[model samples]
Target: MKFMAKIELSRHIPLVTLIVLVLCITPPIFATKNCDFPAIFSFGASNVDTGGLAAAFRAPPSPYGETYFHRSTGRFSDGRIILDFIARSFRLPYLSPYLNSLGSNFTHGANFASGGSTINIPKSILPNGKLSPFSLQIQYIQFKEFISKTKLIRDQGGVFATLIPKEDYFSKALYIFDIGQNDLTIGFFGNKTIQQVNATVPDIVNNYIENIKNIYNLGARSFWIHGTGPKGCAPVILANFPSAIKDSYGCAKQYNEVSQYFNFKLKEALAELRSNLSSAAITYVDIYTPKYSLFTNPEKYGFELPFVACCGYGGEYNIGVGCGASININGTKIVAGSCKNPSTRIIWDGVHYTEAANEIVFSQILTGVFNDPPISLDRACYRK
Candidate 1:
């Protein structure tokens, strides 16, 4: 409910210049908890992306990671993402990106999340005639390949390969999914009407459920599936659809309706999956309510601005340009900058969440309340 006054000096400075100054002045925070989980395998879009897409994306640069790592670590936030917090909670090291070959270590599992990843391969509807290469299906293939190679090495008596128990790793490891946001958003952005997008919900949920089934067949038993959040509250959505009606919390109402519908179907599909895979402890995480609550009552969660982007360039809500956009000032190019207090903001860079927001959501997920069947990650992991 409270808003920080825009910095007068920053208004005159180039965005890039302001970000460099902010990064230099800001100090990183270090806080982690201990929990019990052998390993975590994450697959999703930007919310869980730990840099697997950095090689082909722009998030692995300054400003994006300025708040947390002080530089890009391939995450789309100012600090550690939700998956990072989950890993740290279990006393595990930050999962390495499956794409990064340097010092590849699978001892603690690998993150297959990539920014802009979608649920379907060709996308529900392609607006730009482009398909994301790292779809959920592709990420799953990468996971299968990683496990296969590791198994082969362990079988051949390779040293250090035995650190991960070949037979139990996949079965014991926790599989967490945070996808589906892109599929819905892309559908809307591609000029698909709300009705048309709604029509694709069954197919989207089908693909998602099918992927879970495939993972289950591959030996995964513990699953933590995150439902799509309220995309209508995203700064990017609001900016793109200025005429859209606002909800009680000032978010775009129509977009959120679509998101709710998607979550409903996803939850139903997950229920059916649970029935089919009786051996799998599948928990559907309701990410929408917790995240939407933060926006509705920002003060309750220590956030000042819930809908505005902390890092962006040129727009009413700072959603016109991406976090890394650059502008020329008097023939000299200056990069777009971020907010001074990212911790006080909910949305980060128009599309992602700040580390603070992620922490809050992570806490909700840990409590077991947001999960279907009311099972926490710890319960799902340790259950026999």
Candidate 2:
């Protein structure tokens, strides 16, 4: 049940004017711009989903965006998602959603993250349908670019056609893909043990790697590869398994091990891809340790709540209340609660992070995992 990515109805979307809100916490850090780079295009699941799935789901008032500016902003967070933070950190205007064709901002890029989307298949856990898999999502984007080019060609006739051809839409872009959690979620939620899930993990991951290759072939040079986080600690998972073992930080170690294994293999695959495609810029951003550090050592980060989400109760709650009120393993109601200031806590809903959490995560990306004992992820993306 893949939802269409087309915007047939062109309504005037009331643009909300965002003003500069200076935080008493810290003045916004000016991001060093990569002048040569035009934008950072992100694609993936709920972890980094900006607005790719807004049209996919039915997020109305009350349940979805009760805490938002009186209405849902098409985001799954109380405030901002990871991609928003990333754009701010890079000093680029936030990437728009694939569904939005608001001109003049196309150069900055767009978000293709459909909630519930996995890398291998279109697995949307949202009350919606089958979901838009990473592959189909990419294809949809490619088609959208084609449509955009068609519009450009018709407009320019032959004047600007030669210089700004259809192919150039993607050729001049970078793709950031954050995917692969639902695949694992399916295995666990289904009647499968860790060993059973482990067997298919390689192929599942390879499916995404191949998609990455497909994107590279499509002229995407720069890519941000986001890995998975602990499964057991997620509010939904925690709620289902009351007897689940917990680590020092109360995060389930056994579930984390699964994520650790996948990350290790995926990292190896990415390293090989980098060597194979020397012309490409590939960087792996580990969302685990950075967030884990926050959860494990809240005093260090000065956050109080770690395990339960500030947004929803039950065992889990994302900013959008993803796991909140979600059917328990037994199809029961198990959610309700919201932390006062999502800015202070990390976990937004059960599975995602707060806007504040994303700030810290992006900090790690700009200078932590993605950084080197070096300049940039690859020489190709380095500023001259």
Best by TM-score: 1
lDDT of 2 by residue, 99-217 (tens): 54433245466566677777665445445554554443464456457446656675867654443324444655556777778887778777788788777789877887887887776
Q: Which residue runs of candidate 1 sit more than 4 Å off their true CA positions?
A: 1-35, 56-59, 123-131, 158-166, 382-384
Give lDDT for model 1: 0.82
Compute each candidate's TM-score over C-alphas.
0.86, 0.75
Q: Model 2, residue 78: displacement in angstroms?
A: 1.1
Candidate lDDT values, in order: 0.82, 0.63
Model 2 poorest 10 in a row by lDDT: 13-22
Query: In model 1, which residue pairs have backbone atoms overlapping below 3 Å?
Result: 15-337, 16-335, 68-78
Per-residue lDDT, model 2, residue 199, is 78
lDDT of 1 by residue, 304-362 (tens): 86778998877788866678778786998877788989999998888889999999989
Give the number of colliding residue pairs in candidate 2.
12
